[model samples]
Target: MSTIIYPAPIFGPVHSRRLGVSLGINLLPGDGKFCTFDCIYCECGYNKDFRPKQKVQTREAVREALEKRLAEMKENGPFPDVLTFAGNGEPTANPYFPEIIEDTLALRDKYFPNAKVSVLSNATLIHNPKVFAALNKVDNNILKLDTVDMDYIRTVDRPTGHYEVENIIEGLKAFKGNLIIQTIFMKGTTEDGKDVDNTSDKYVLPWLEVVKQINPRQVMIYTIDRETPDQKLKKATKEELDRIARLVEEAGIKASASY
Candidate 1:
């Protein structure tokens, strides 16, 4: 069976197990996709050979669309539970990310007071002071940290030249107790067909160190539910996820698994 793909600026008020009835706000280009990491498990498909030419949507454009959608939804009776900043790629990569957050907050207050503003970032741009400040403002600051081991991180996330695992972890630590760390667990084959699984003690031990350092409010542990570009990839079982969650909680951190 073919995988379901949702592509558009305001694609869905879809049911999300984590976020719940989210009204998606895609900051990246509608036609073109731009991302810092080119992971094998990307649901948007693998990053293309050429760089995305189109720029991210402006703050005004995002705000206007959100306001209009909220107004329409209100009149229609039921509205989304959250206004999620998720799209083709990393939402924080936009240069005007802070301004966008500010505008979204304002719009949320005005139109849908009950709705919360959430951002799904790769945590690559958290190293930037401005980006960090912006992320701190959101109701749900969902940041990704797949692994802490440099070799495993490189193999899993496949981040760009500018991004360093140490730098990303440092940025995350700077957030202290204010953030939510999201880890997507998977057992897959690398592009070259090498076995990739971080559930083992050796791979997860380093990640636990980072978790202790950051001390986030919550740690979301989940495995792949959708088709990825790499056909050889396999999803981790519920029992495996539960075991990892137990380890995380044993370390005095809150963990939730989505199997």
Candidate 2:
């Protein structure tokens, strides 16, 4: 079984392949994983493996913790390049996400005005008007979109309930030019030995069409960088990622591949 990745709420000015020098802000409860999607590639492990007794952090607590970390980083030098909302689970699931984003913005302004504020969301809660509004205020409103195929999504992302791929794609489109779409391209099988691959043109073409519709500022193409819930899964090579990125570029969208 894969271990829990992030057990703390506020952790590290860690080096990120996508967002440089990131300070993670986990909006979920400190002791467990809670998310709308149970993706096979999730580095934090399968959702069923996590259930914590701790409660979600209050807005005040988040504010206080962020302020303390920012102050410490400022005094010590090497201020973070980005304050990212990402960890064990969904940030927006906290119910106070709008208010948290507001606090983070203010704190970012106070500490590192030039640094970017990003959210590494699964894009599950964007239907909420408050969440949508708050996401717009960030420097990088990164949203996941592995493939446009619903079957592929169901196999990998496994969004809870009757959640549809079209719904997520449309919601991301509503972001207009404010969105940064992130894709994790890979080919392999699930733990059950089920074949699941999205690295082919069959998946990439339609996915690019959705990207064109969304017309985001940037498209982040990456592969599994750490161990995932599905051991049978294989990571996409940097070259394959670049090839897919070239297609996005051809469609007049900016892109980057992180292997």
Top candidate, metric lDDT: 2
User: In candidate 2, where is summed lDDT lowest over 10 consecutive residues?
Assistant: 1-10
Residues 1-259 of candidate 2 have per-residue lDDT tens digits of 6565674569888899988999999888777788899998888888888776788778998999889989999999678999999998888888888999999999999889999999998898899999999999999999988888888888889987668888888899999879999999988899887778788889899999989999999999999888887889998877888899999999999999998
Q: What lDDT is reached at residue 227 by model 2?
A: 82
lDDT of each structure?
A: 0.82, 0.88
What are the clashing pairs of model 2? none
Q: What local lDDT score does residue 203 receive in model 1, on the 0 to 100 scale? A: 71
Task: Name the runs in model 2 displaced over 4 angstroms.
Answer: none
TM-score of 1: 0.94
Clashes of 2: 0
lDDT of 1 by residue, 154-240 (tens): 777888767778878888888878899999888878769777887888877888888989899999989988888778888988988
C-alpha RMSD for every candidate:
1.8, 1.1
